[model samples]
Target: MTRASSQSDPFRLRAWIKVLAVGQLSYASAVAAADLAVPHPIAEGSNYTDWSGGYIGLQGSASGAYGDYAFSRTTVGGRAVPSFMSGDGTGRRDQGTTATTIVGGAFGGYNWQTGPWVYGVEADLSASNLKRPLPSTITGFGYEDADAFNIIRAKTDVFGSLRARLGYSFERYLVYGAFGLSGTNARFIGNYPDIDTGALNVAKHEVSFIGFNIGAGVQYAITESLALGLDYRYLDFGNSRRFSLGSVPGDAGGPVGTQANFNAHQLFLRLMWFPGGLRVPPDPAEIAPHDPDDGNSDRYSLHGQTTLIAQGTPGFRSPYVGDNSLIPHQARQTTTATIFLGLKVTDTTELYYNPEFSQGFGLSGTHGVAGFVNGEAQKAGAPYPRLRSNRYYIKQTINLGGETEDVPDGPNQVATRRDVNRITLLAGKFALGDFFDGNIYAHDPRVDFFNWSLWGSSAWDFPANLPGFTQGVYAEYNQAKFAVRAAATQVPKEQNSDVLDPRVFERAGLNAEFEGRYVLPWLDQSGKLRLGVFSNVGNVANNREIVTLTQLGIFDDINTAAVVTSKPRRKTGGYVNLEQALTPDLGLFARASLNDGRTTSLSFTDIDQSFSGGLSLKGTAWDRPGDTVGLGAAMNGLSPSHRAAFAAGYYGLLVGDGQLRYGTERAVETYYAINLTKFVTLTFDYQFVNNPNYNRDRGPAHFFASRLHADF
Candidate 1:
């Protein structure tokens, strides 16, 4: 019998999803009513608009699945099956388990309308985290004098549907019903201990199935090109056949087989766009004149972007190797696509969601250097494409009655006018970098610098999960010349782990920053200075303790020692970020950050201190105003205790050679971005690292990269 880790709880995940749902709906009601207040004026005296075109949309959904896991029979070579598996002739069985989760995805279809009737075909694909644990029946079996038990788990990660729809139009609203074929990729995993040796035996079976689906919904045309809708869908996957739970040839029990039926119900809020949509030109007199400084004033906005990066390194020196060392010559690539969806509930309120697809890995699985290359590469990299909801948050602004300024339309932001002095509150899941760090010259990896240290404060150790996001609340008070921002968030449960710690009061992250803007005294150019501080309390181990444990022979190595010695400890740090505009086409940015380095690093790289500076220049000199060139360098260092741990073969979150020749890791990076069009850009990047992984004997490595990016 194997035990599940106590730190992980499914209820916590469900609880957060529930919080997100309640928060969204509570505010969405206001939006629904507000949407009806201003109706589009009828054009050409027509009561209906054309609904004939191809459309695509993004959706956020809540889904539940009921699964019957009753096992009908069991066979294991010549060995007698366990009582639980064989049902013991007593007919004792587990009825079922229900799984619920929040999901996000993309959909597209074509619609045709004639008079009051409309018809269409649609298809959608979504990623899921629907999972539930199953209760195991007593088998009346013994393993080495200990009672034996089993653990059963059921989960679904991906699902989709193809359907045909029919609807009736009522002016701007359309009510529809749909029937479709649906399928899900599911899994049933089992854990059993060896009856004699008490060793663990694992088995997993793919439990995917096809099903029939039915749904209905209503949509309202908010604009000629945009629509908002709500839908409910039901899917029934009939009983499945008995299948093996996987086993090797020489196992005591041959294999386990089980049968089950699955069914699901899903509710969705969809925002769609119609391509080549028919438009009723508004009366010229009713239209407002465009103002360049006023920016875009749309009720809602949609934007998307995709980035692909391929990087390689040339041969470098390496006298020895450790568990996490970069190879001399290597190549790797990563690709990502994201859709930014936003809705303005009111003049002061907005909701946003970003669904993303990612694949590929960083070189050497994102290790070998403290100041690593490839900012786009996630620590939890995947070889195959995976879809995930990266960000979904609500932003509310309270005006203090001052001069108004225009806010530009961009990803996660809708164009509007805001008070010069206002208080903004954000709640939900998002990356800390989105709001805290403001460096126009070196921030964004897709368009500017590509090295991790250059693009962000590497020593901050901000709270985040595997993909670098966290659920939390953030607030900012902005004035004409200064801004103050703060956030409290959940930290990862373990070092570089995707699971977040549920003990918010005891294990959380807090961050704050003060930004001041001013003009240079002599140059008369604008410059900004930002001071940031962060403190994290979590289950992290101190480097000194791990080193001590190793010295006493209580632990054989640093990796194992750190895990065993972990306790609730505090890690605090601060940073200075500065950016200056040298000219209209040239800018300079720099950052210096440091952490206590007493405990092991948690969410980010292992650098205890780092300094990076960069220069960004537009290609106006060459008459290519849309092009850019960047150059940056970073120096990363570790605290004395951290250095001692590394010298003693103590592994860090990243970077650790079996032995250490300590050195301040230094790297220089440069990139050139060529804007092929307003929506597309191609960039070439290169970086050189000295003393990779802080090991002086290891390398003076060189890296080259090519990136392609598109957005609209």
Candidate 2:
């Protein structure tokens, strides 16, 4: 009985295993067969077909956003200080808890589609202006009843993206993924009035960043000739850091720091038409043999497209401006346009040129140039008159006192006053290959022509020791889940001299970055974890003038100044970043970085180190048509120089201390976009910043902006 039972059990187990294997095989076969079937409606003819072509379209949108700014004061020394400070002060401060702004712009792109799959590249650009306000009252150090009020302004005259997309179609709906490079030109403007002294001041700054973008979207085909799509993009523009100070008295001459990152969700509805219904050339099997009339060439076809877009510029910091200030806290806008283009080429290859021109106006404008330039000079206590000489050829001796005493007396004249005009032209070609693709070219990336507004400002007028030609090349490779980039630049030692001075100082540097992503198979379909690393290395030529300044007690009386003057210094450093995707529309990211000071070379004795890190979150809700939203926040620690500036601004505000320390700076920002209808969209955004170094009278500050966009 035991033998019989054991034999039966073995047979039963084998039978069950066979049954399960057969079932699995059947399921695999079913799936394979289903995949082979046509994914989209097809015209009766050949077994396969391709409608691989390029297209162009136009889009418009509207948006709005709000910003919050905060500041605080801290004491560094026991010395008595002034009560009112200029620019950003040392003490804690807050501006319009929330300020609203408006903006708008236009965009266009090209695409190619095939059976169940599509691949193509696209480019888009836009312009916008936004504003906000700020107000504050300060009292301390023999000074009281000091009040400062002003508006903060911002103008994003430019935003652009270059991306490549790959997608799979499920009948009328298409799911796609994209990766690319993006850039933007943005500016900040601030205006403030000192109540105690009844003095008005203004400041402005411009900055740019280059980074990578990753995104996903879905497209729905409404008809044979019309389609609509919604996409979410996370743009990591790296760090766009700028240094500036407000025009307040004690706050003057401190570092004004700014950093920016952008992420957005966009939904677009488009209409498309093709002259001939995806015509397929005659298949040999379907055509009469050698028939003279059986030509495969297709007649000319015409297509048109129009799209409505909704987008947001969420995280912005304008501590110097208030909610209602003339300056916009955050700006959002919508734009609309129609595109018309023709396509013609052979099957083996095609050559085409698409020339596009568009115009749209939204809430956008930087601080006026005059106000920003003068404000910077005023903060330094140099002012315009102190920088210019009334008598061009006459030498005059004048006694310097008060704030002017801080200004270096030697070589005070502008040695190189120049108005620069720069233009860039880029052209490249792609060769289609069976396996690998390659590209090569030699072109002038950027060219600048300058007019010497004043002889003193001319680079040629400066001593051979102070050459001034800054130029370089930058490039990177971007993939679906990873990216890498490197760049090198050179700062000439002399403007026109053929001889390169080894002692005068020259600069050469390189920067690199790497990022990767890993999808979590056990989690939801969209979950992923990412990691990245970035580094930079460079050398800076030494300058005699710098050594002299150090000897004159300008830079802490460091003896290493002579060594720095004799030879260029070398600098090397890097950063690390990690991120995780919680869902299809949500994610968290963190990063840390360190650098060896601003100059190219590192002197072990004067070595400077900086570290910074932060977290960010982004996601979208698909409840409404043509509407999408996103949010992010970050905090960073500055170096001693940055801390000093922060401390200076803090103390200068509460105690009227002139000393500046660069301290820690932190910021938080968010944004949202909603579509009211096919022709209109609304956008809102806000940003909050905390800085111990800002020199504005309002202390730590806040900023906000918003906008309404329309499409036609």
Candidate 3:
């Protein structure tokens, strides 16, 4: 192609331009028409929060539940006691009752997304303090108005769930259905004015059971890997199972609790995060299950305690009541060492063994004072060190259900979590005090009050050999606010010896205790009341019979009547102890006990009726937070038969004199303990006695002691 001259090319240019314009116009029209016919896909799909990933989330919910609970006395010998049997819903709360509570927990799950379909599994656990009030007026537990429990309270402690989710995704929103298993823990507590020893009898239980959970949820994506979800769920846990007569939930062959339907409903607002998200999930096998709930750490722990006490009395002597007299100017010392070994065999089983060594002497060999001063001091002893396998036992716990308590590692305790409502079975050797007649403020002499009368009921004479060791079996039914315990122990071969009888059926000790625990928030206080009854079948002399023989000049000593009479008789008694925490730094405790005084003195001191009270105060009030001061008093009285036998110049093992001018033995004791460190304590104690050993002729005297204790 050649161009002509400029003037001549103008005509040719115009012709070329016309052709180019027509071509451009036709192409523009085609592009405009095609744009109308087809448009670009929306960007909503790309912005959706990817569901194909694992996520951990926090969930909060409003929950309500309904159930039935029956409060009846636990059974003994396969039969319910008449006093405790509540056949008429006397202290029961029925179904159709509701309570509202808030719950929060962490949940983790992984989702698999295939096109519009999504599937996932999740697990969660939560805790709550939920309560409801019920109307109930129950009486006759004890023979006092204060013994009645008029108000009933129900509480829920914890819950958990494992769920599988299926959903349909619509771009940025999902609608899902959830199916899973769920469980809850709860209990019922009864209380009123008298509720003495209510700590043992309060209908407190921890019950744990499984149920089916079904729910639906809707979620909205907020980012590529985050979403907000709202869910509604229903749990059908079935009935709250009945506990055994002892309110034991899982005792073999125990009675099932009264049939009671139980269930819950909840609504949750949840925030979720899907890390490592994708639009489409990889192979199912490639998904790793993330579990973080089972890393509680094995609890291997140790504990030990040692106590040394040195006591002295200044020039105090007795003439008449030699058998029960405190000798003149005596100085005594006691040393106790114990090592506790605990093994957690399983989730619900524990084995504990305590090897204890004791070396000590009490004032006048621990005879004069009916209300013994030293709890660790035994009557019969070889001043040389005595080694006793004080506590060797296996405890198996079965949970029924309710709130869970994390049990820290300690002596005779396994480190784990457990339902509050449970049954505990123990067998082997242990102290009767370990299972019965426990007073929170006065129980442990190594730490708290140390007077024997303040430590235990003087008149009950709980069965034991020297050093308070016995072979026996015990069953405990526990709940949130109360507990019931029963035990069968072998009595000593002799009345007050340190040997278990080879024939258990011939000389046995059976005991039952009911306890109640209460927290008074208004007064910032907590209290425990315990009621226990104990019976011992052993060779014993009747004081009345011995006295009759002495009146006829037929008895040289009370022991002669025991040899002439038939085999030993059954001796029974009961005690009630109450301990209250007035404040975080102050406590009050009291105990009253009575026993048939017809029997001669046995394993414990001689007192037919005993009363004791005390107060303990921490030094926080005086800005000395580690110091504690305590003051206590005890009164011991003898039965008419016992007094008469003593009056006739007949001596017994302890507490009998050449001549008897019977008067109640009264003692007042005070102690101040200085805490030098977390594990060490030094205490100074003093006691004043009036009419020691019930003998009016003995001079009132003063006893003093210094105690040093170390524990870990």
Candidate 4:
């Protein structure tokens, strides 16, 4: 669990202002629309509003599903593609599971009313991405004699409904039931890794499914053209058969059939717009206040964020492609779903867990620059779908006595009151970046800057295992004006690996930070400054040592040295981070850091020194308040000793150009996010990278990205 952030007074004031402003706007709209209410000819003198017109709206739904799949596999002949020989050991099987999730989309409809009865037709487009993936073992695509694990994932991307509705009108409300024809576009992906051949295989296919839907709903009119409603819908998409052709040596197909089936039941909230439609007689005493985030007032709540990103770079100059060089003109897409689960164990204690599922690869497999573009994409892109626990922890908060303030509800946070002065203790497995190097304007890639260098002080060399997580215990003391924090974490046994050293006491990393927060006197807005220091003792290989050994013909290369080094190394670094809110709609952030230049990067990427700065602007000026745009730039430099290694044709995981003309790697990134609806956003991003792989001889690269994100 994470402690509630103690925000400055100015920040709290800004939040309340925004909330009140939005409420006022909604109320004003309701009042005006009431005056334009349409009357029902068939229900004259009745209290109910007329329900006869065309309407369009948006909705958010929570759905629970129950389903099953019975798929069969068969091989065509004794010899086809010789890699996988199905039927020899594997055959038909049944797979099933159940879960609940949420979906959001738009709906449009038309209705005709006669007396107290109403008839209509409606259509909607919605999406759901939460489900379990199936796992299998096979041999074929990559090799015949070796068995390997194969993971298969399938999803119903966008499902649409065309329904016929029938309803009976009440004094000021309506009750209706609907049945409809539904269609869905489904996608299937299979990944198999052959241990014998040391390679991975990926297979993909897409198909459309037609189904039926039935549901019931109730609605009440707030004004003539605007109404509030609740709906329940159930959908059944029947089986879709799949067939495959032989691949490699052992992959054969002979009447091999796989069927995909799915069903769902949803309860949704609807906001409808029916211009020149009907309205109910005003009943002030019966009007209920609208609370959008219903469960947010509770001590225990849930939140989630999912994003799908697709990126590509038009061919750039790459005279040669080394192990880590970015491939020109290549494109890739990735999707991630994270569930935030939190529980309040006591008034002063909380527990939280995060589980994530990710699919897709980064551009050129997350290579080319030491300051990689996608912070969410690690080198761990697998041939199959993956599920991992991102975080699990407990937090304790103790009041030291001071002013009391309310903490707003959000992911990993509870709606409660806390003292201005407090001490927080946290222990568990989590990402160091989550607590140490945080920035209001650039920290989370899901909503802010997507580049690693911009989100964190690149040169700090924070100790993190692969997936950017670490195990540790930390303590923080906070006052109205300042905060002090310290943490001790275990380092990974090897570079970028998930395994931590067992003898943690002998190979540990330490971090300490001092934070000073205040409001700019003239601006009357919040701003923060954090200065931090980090030190680590671990058995890691350094660039200088690898280069020296290669020069003496005692080692093959730097990559090889990382696997065998048992010598302990000491590394220390310091960083300065600042964030300032110039206005409610504008903010600025900057970070600069320098490390001891003498040791290996052990965890993150290859920069020993770095500087990054950026400004973020909210879309209030354009009247699209939920949208945002950001502009940022960063510069990364290798230490003298490390530079010597790269200059000698040695390499790190993300960079090594096969030759040398060392220069500082620089990057500039900008993105604009447009909120399509309250729950969905589309972002366009571009980045220009200079001195790819830290080699002056290599290209300046240009990357383009389109991102779609939805949250519940």
lDDT of each: 0.75, 0.33, 0.66, 0.69
Lowest lDDT sum, 10 consecutive residues, model 1, at 86-95
lDDT of 1 by residue, 1-712 (tens): 0111222344445433532442243223223433322233445655555667789887764322222334445545534443332121111112233333456688999998887688999999988766655555534333324432235677788879999999986555677899989998878887766666656667888877898999777665655666656566778887788777653233445565656667765656566777665443343324555342442347777877767676767567877767677765555556676889998888899999999866555776677888889888887665434678999999999999969998777799887888999999999999999998779998888888998899999999999987899999999999999999999999999888899899998899999999999999787799999999999988889999899999999998777998988888999999999999998899999999999999899988999999999899999999999999999999999999999999998767678877888999999998888775455566878899999989998889988777767675
TM-score of each: 0.63, 0.32, 0.58, 0.65
Q: Rank the candidates by TM-score, best first.
A: 4, 1, 3, 2
Give candidate 1 misplaced runs (Cα > 4 Å).
Answer: 1-297
Task: Give candidate 2's TM-score.
Answer: 0.32
Poorest 10 consecutive residues of model 3 by lDDT?
Answer: 85-94
lDDT of 3 by residue, 30-109 (tens): 23322111122323434233476688777654221223334444343354533221122111112212243445567898
The candidate scoring highest on lDDT is: 1
Clashes of each: 0, 116, 33, 13
lDDT of 2 by residue, 1-712 (tens): 0010112454334323322321222122222322212234355543333334444433322222212233223121222222221222111123222232222233445557665677878776644332333343333321234333443344455557789999875434456898999776656565545445656567887767677878765554433333344444555665555345354334422223333333333322222222232323234334433321222322112222222222112222333432111121222222222222222232212122222211121222211010110001111111001111101111112222222111111111211111122111111211001001100010000000000110011101111111112234434444445445444433234222223234322444344445454677776533222222222222333333443455467665322433344344444555444455555544444334455333322211111332222222222344553544444333433334423332322111011122322333444544454454343344444545454222233224343333233322
| Candidate 1 TM-score, true structure as reference | 0.63
Q: Write the per-residue lDDT of candidate 4 for residues 597-674, one digit (tens) a residue.
A: 786677888889999999999999999898899999999998888888777766675777666788999999999987
Off by over 4 Å in 4: 1-297
Worst 10 residues of 2 by lDDT: 442-451
